[model samples]
Target: MIVTSFFSLFISQTVFAKNMYRWIDDKGRIHYSETVLPKDINYRRESLNKAASVKEVVEEAKTKEEQEMEKRLVRLRRDQEKIITRQKVYDNALLNTYHSKADLMMAIKSKMDAFETQNQVVEGNLIRLKQELEAQQKNAAEMDRNAQKVPKKLLDGIKSTQKQIQELHIAINEQKEKQSQIKREDEADIARFLFLTQSLTEKRKGTSIPSIKEANELGLFYCENDRQCNKAWEIARTFVEYYSTTPPDVYNDKLIMNRPPATDTDISLSLSKIPLTDDESQLFLDVHCRESSLGKDLCVSQKVKDIRATFIPYVNDALSRTAQ
Candidate 1:
């Protein structure tokens, strides 16, 4: 059964090519077998292809099965080579971008500080805009409640103020999103910068990078090999699943979201403009109920332009917080 299973695997691997062995026997007869015989002598192995290398070889020497996989293996090597080349370029860029990793961290922090400051300013503007818009809306409502024809002057005032309010609201909303995006990117850069600098630091002292493949994957934020990163990604997935896909079992038309702590006051107006399904409405409400770093980031990231952005930022944030 074992031999049969072995042959089954072998055939699965080598069905594209057949091994040819040639030998001149004592009777002056040439004999060939697919499988190499024990204690075989005077047998010559055939070359399957011209483009064969040690990388293309399997188990010490190239075999017919190896030849069958040659083209496929070559394509895979090309793909891997591209990944390696891209990573090497990034390594060089990291080394050149700053005098040291500390310098990079300083720059990243400065950029993040700028984002936070900008968000604060936008928040203040939003507060003023909301107040102004409310006053204008109140005046218009009182005029209507008195059963008076809405005067052209008051109508114009309300329209102008409403337009300005919408513009400011969208501006602040967009800026908050940028803030979250920058934070996400900063975390990833910090992780990659530390990995690159540490590896290079050790290389200067004669030890090579721990494992080029591993460093490359980490540097790229390929979270498959990282448990914390994977968990963070799972958290992000749940947010996306709940918010973007899985709808609340029952849609609550009366359950209007009056903005969570993030204070998206314009969202009500904005939400009214867009045609949202019951599922999407439930999603918006459900998102307001959840509280997590990943959930907070999603609050900013989701927009009409990108209802389905990957949660890599959340993953990066999680990875950066994980210890050595």
Candidate 2:
């Protein structure tokens, strides 16, 4: 009975428990193992039974610094997604709100007219309330000067009239402020609406952004002929991240295609925003080498020189800290 129970338990664990140890090696490649990890390596435990993609599982394993970097990346991706979702919602709302700039202008004018008419009513009431309160105060002053107690009803009337006048003033100011805000918002909305609509029309007519894969292919075109293909793959992964996130305007004028109709010119890239940090940037930039008949590969771009200049010092600085 004991042997049969033990066998059943073993079978259940083998079938149901798909525990995995995920880790990144010194070379930054992600690895997954079912039973044993490398003799000296630390791994993060993961359950493969869960619906996690291989990419997500790999991302789950990282060093402390890598984890912080990933956190920042996740936050940025979330913020970008929100911006895209908000843009879609605004685009829909814009379409439903008005048919043309003229239509929007007319709508704004009508709202302005309504506000002006309401404010005129409020102003007239405020004038009347002020007059009544002033008259009541004068009456109370006259009674006090003659050494007589102010009439209770008259004092009450004065207080109530003053309150009404204050309330009207507040209402008028609030209404005017809201109208100004609405006009400003409408102006911005119309501009954005026109831009978004125009872009959408152009996209429908076939002018569209390049796909991330296409951008990666473009970067790989120059590096794909490397002897082992290691450098090319690394460059492709880095380019994929860069192309997907960086604004096209930053490099639209300076796109370097390695195997184009032009000769090899070392390109220097400076972006308004760099998605990779110092170390992460070095990891990809360090892979640039071309096979030459003279036995050793010479550097092509001054950009690569800059990378080496900064990366070596950065690594040394980090190593010094560990030594301390």
Candidate 3:
């Protein structure tokens, strides 16, 4: 009987330990047992620990799978980020190499307009001067041919006209010098402008990538290479210096001609009347001849006749001093 009772007690304890309960006492201390606790005791179900619970085995497997999936997603995100960064770098390099070709063409057009307008101004002045010089020559020739036959008052008029002719010649030459000087300055400006534009074109044509070393050194945004950064700076500098003087918008407009104070009234008025044409060569020649003939100190008579013959309409009212 004693051995049987001992075996029964051992069996009961093993069963109790297998189905445990957890409770907290009024004092907040936790207790664990196999039997049901009193009603006053607040009981809670206990979660399994890795060392003591079978549920822990299943939970561990789920946790491991979740961790592996998270790792794969993180890797995929990192790879995608790398691809985006590389593509951005290449795009920036391409951007550094060019302005839009259309923009360059527009700039060229503006330059051409300015050139044409300036040349027109010069041509107009020349045409007017030619007309006046011819009239002066014709008057002087008439006076010389009929000197003895003229009255005393008319003789004085002939001498006065001759003096005016001499003065006109001096004025014409001075105008020529000023015009030549302006042309030289304008040429320089145009050359520098063209150089900057062509540089952009050449850079676009080449396939060279920006230098990484340069970009790292500069630490500037969009600077894939040193050359790009440098070129950008240069373009900015040119714009500030040149474009500021005559803004592109203003330069593109038809130029307003301002005649010099010393310009002959007849010549100035006549030139102002002639309209400009699109042909640059003819315009250039007209400008050169007009500005030059006015300033010529030698043979004003010959120049006056020559220019009058070239543009005959300018001298239609040759002797009219009012120039209308």
| Cα-based lDDT for every prediction | 0.52, 0.54, 0.42
Candidate 3 — which residues are off by over 4 angstroms? Answer: 1-99, 148-324
lDDT of 2 by residue, 253-291 (tens): 123223211213322223221112222121222222334
Per the 3 Å backbone cut-off, how many clashing residue pairs does candidate 2 have? 0
**What lDDT tens digits, residue by residue, belong to model 1 across residues 43-156?**
344323322211222233457887879978999999999999998897788778877767988898888788778878877877887787788778879989999777898788
Which residue pairs of candidate 1 clash? none
Error of 1 at 184 (Å): 2.6
Off by over 4 Å in 2: 1-39, 42-61, 68-72, 200-324
Pairs that collide in candidate 3 are 124-271, 126-290, 172-294, 172-295, 173-294, 173-295, 173-296, 174-295, 176-291, 211-225
Q: Encode model 3's per-residue lDDT on 136-190: one tens digit a residue.
A: 5566578779873445765566566556656656655666676667667555545
In model 1, the runs with Cα more than 4 Å from the true position are: 1-73, 156-160, 163-170, 212-324
TM-score of each: 0.44, 0.46, 0.21
lDDT, candidate 2, equals 0.54
Best by lDDT: 2
